[model samples]
Target chain A: MTTTALKARKEFGKTLASDIAHRLRNEIVTCQLKPNESLKFDALRLSFGASFTTLREALTLLAAEGLVVAEEQRGYKVAPVTLEDLHDLTHARILIEVDLMRRSIEKGDDDWEIRVISSLHRLARIEERAPEDYASNTEWKAAHRQFHEALVSASGSPTLLAVRNSLFDRAERYRNLSAMFRPHPRDKAGEHRALMQAAIGRNADQACNLIASHIQTTSNNVAKYASGVISAG
Target chain B: MTTTALKARKEFGKTLASDIAHRLRNEIVTCQLKPNESLKFDALRLSFGASFTTLREALTLLAAEGLVVAEEQRGYKVAPVTLEDLHDLTHARILIEVDLMRRSIEKGDDDWEIRVISSLHRLARIEERAPEDYASNTEWKAAHRQFHEALVSASGSPTLLAVRNSLFDRAERYRNLSAMFRPHPRDKAGEHRALMQAAIGRNADQACNLIASHIQTTSNNVAKYASGVISAG
Candidate 1:
């Protein structure tokens, strides 16, 4: 093969690996793959219609992101959920997210303000829709992530943002798990609006306080429901 | 094979993969593997006496730790350093480390205090041996890491420590790079002593202030040297 042909093949392989990782990540986070369940290589390859190399690469990537755990000779398994993990994750998230919000308030420009507002609007609209509708729930989750991302977009620190993003994703898995077990009625809309108002008002102290409480409340709810589910199972 | 024999073989594979990852991580952080240089799998497999699968898994693990970067089409490469990265890293470190130190002071027991003093003693001894000796420098780095780790060991948050450890390793790479380009004389020993004093005194604010300044001074120096090294290269 010519150099160009080899390069194209390599590129295709990389893309294929990334695509498979994305799909697998979604499955794991949505609990479709189920937590703590062993992931058999041959089964995953057949299910994803991917080559062995591609599937292995995808799993390795997920393992790096903590969505999957690489076992010795046992192959990979979906990362398990526990209250301790959630507590640690929540504590770390509060630290990073609060700091990022403070920096964002100090450095965020008009664009950042607009992004926050737009995300808030979108999320509120989705919340008004059927809260139990799976599709709308997914949309709500995405909008929620967008709003949080916008809140920290102007932290002007890539490292902070990256750390915050990772913590956010981990916490998300627990949140999703909790949602499945117990659909509690809460005024999420009011809380988010308060958060938005503080952020836009450029009250770093208030914003940080709001965010901490917001995260802690969700964490408490998730912990309660997740424990119930685990104990019942 | 018997079940025990099969288990042993599986354990061996896991150990080999972990060993390779550890060795590669050291090389990357120490600049034995140059930053941004492509990690050719064939070359690495030949050098490490490992199979392609083992080597890939090792690389994937390092990529997760941010010690290596996985590029599309291209393969893994040592994560590169830039001024922007340094700034962001330092900022995040200050936020996390200071908060951790505060918690450590508030929550630390006598044992934690003993560990901090012990680590400081070891580091100070190492510093006195040879501040610039290449062979002893590695020992100094290890001791330094230990001292800092001890300072935050009482934070009581595993997630915080994990994030802090990753950031610490990345910063070490930059410090190593700066040491190569420019060796400035600073009373690092005294700074560390003051830091230790504050911590033992249970003065959270003072300890945090000392650490923040200490980190900032090193950051500024490293930034100055790193920019010159990059530009010259």
Candidate 2:
């Protein structure tokens, strides 16, 4: 009943759940598991090699994050991606990311602006290549994500950024789907540069418009491939 | 491989994990578990009286949904809500919901409009008073959610709708937080009426703006109280 005891009890409870959730999350987000893939318990148990208690602890955390789909009679499967999902996701992505960018443009200081510019520079230098057969190519993906993340990092709202990050992750699966098919567009670099320039110049309105269009551009491209896959099946 | 053999392999591979994920998702989203609460596995296992495999399946599914947060060292805990999170979440909510409303309006026919009107009416009739001494009132919450969901149900984009639902669940936690503070503004009824009218009238631009403002109005109110709490602490 004491205050200290109550605090300890609460902390202990939180610690366990969060730990399990973290491991499961990294596995899914990292694509250690494939999309729409079934997650078998015995397999998962052996994979983690942890006790049932600890593994359950982790899974409950993952369930809350929406990486897996829960079926009625069926068990969890990795969440699937479709072109329709991608389009809407991109729409929401542009809305949130562009909004964040605009906010960052308004609230961001010179240092924040510099950070955005630097992240862009890193992205510009990294060459985009196939994720497979071209092992070094993942650096490009990582850099590209960092650049986009940097633009909104100074938006001054953790919740917005967190949601933004989740949307980005969901989009990533779709992005991967399209990765092997199309050649990297030439204009992407130019598009990003314009976006950075607008933000740094504090043209919040134009920046928002550009970001929205930029987000839509990718969605339109991804939709074609996703639709084909969905339609074929 | 024979067709039957392949089919059997697929069937056998799918089990336990996703099944548990589905059940756990329902428990969390239906508010079976309180927000910011810890999910104790031992207790959950006993409650369901199922094996460890069954529980882990459910928890993993929830994690994918972003309803739970995974901590590195800690176990699974329900995602917490703060005033900052509410502010960001509400803004994102308005952005998505308003856009969905516009799409729904554009795609909706007479029946779609009727559904919205009916859902709002049902919500208006629901008793807002707590249902019992211990349990939160489910009827009002269900009605409230249905009204908003109905507005976007005809948006014709499953992906957008799914993301919208996820954000709504997170927002519910904040709503719960605000509920404990004091009486919310009483004019929510009027605002919903206006929103429904604008959508039915097919005033896409007006409906969009109205919804944006409508969502902001509530967010601002809730946030004001939440901020006060933070500052006091």
Candidate of highest TM-score: 1
Give a tens-digit lDDT track for model 2, residues B105-137: 989987898889999888766643442321135
Clashing pairs in model 1, backbone N/Cα/C closer than 3 A: none
What lDDT does each candidate get? 0.83, 0.69
Candidate 2 stretches greater than 4 Å from native? A1-68, A76-81, A128-136, A183-187, A223-233, B1-70, B76-81, B127-137, B181-185, B223-233
Residue A42 Cα positional deviation in candidate 1, in Å, after optimal superposition = 3.8
Model 1 regions more than 4 Å off: A1-14, A51-53, A71-74, A131-136, A230-233, B1-14, B131-136, B231-233
- List model 1 lDDT by residue over A10-109, tens digit each: 3424577777787888888888888898999888977877777678878878876678888766788998887777877888899889999999999989
Interface DockQ of candidate 2: 0.30
**Interface C-alpha root-mean-square deviation, candidates in order:** 2.3, 5.5
Candidate 1 lDDT tens digits, B62-127: 887788998876788988777877888899899999989999999999999999999999988886
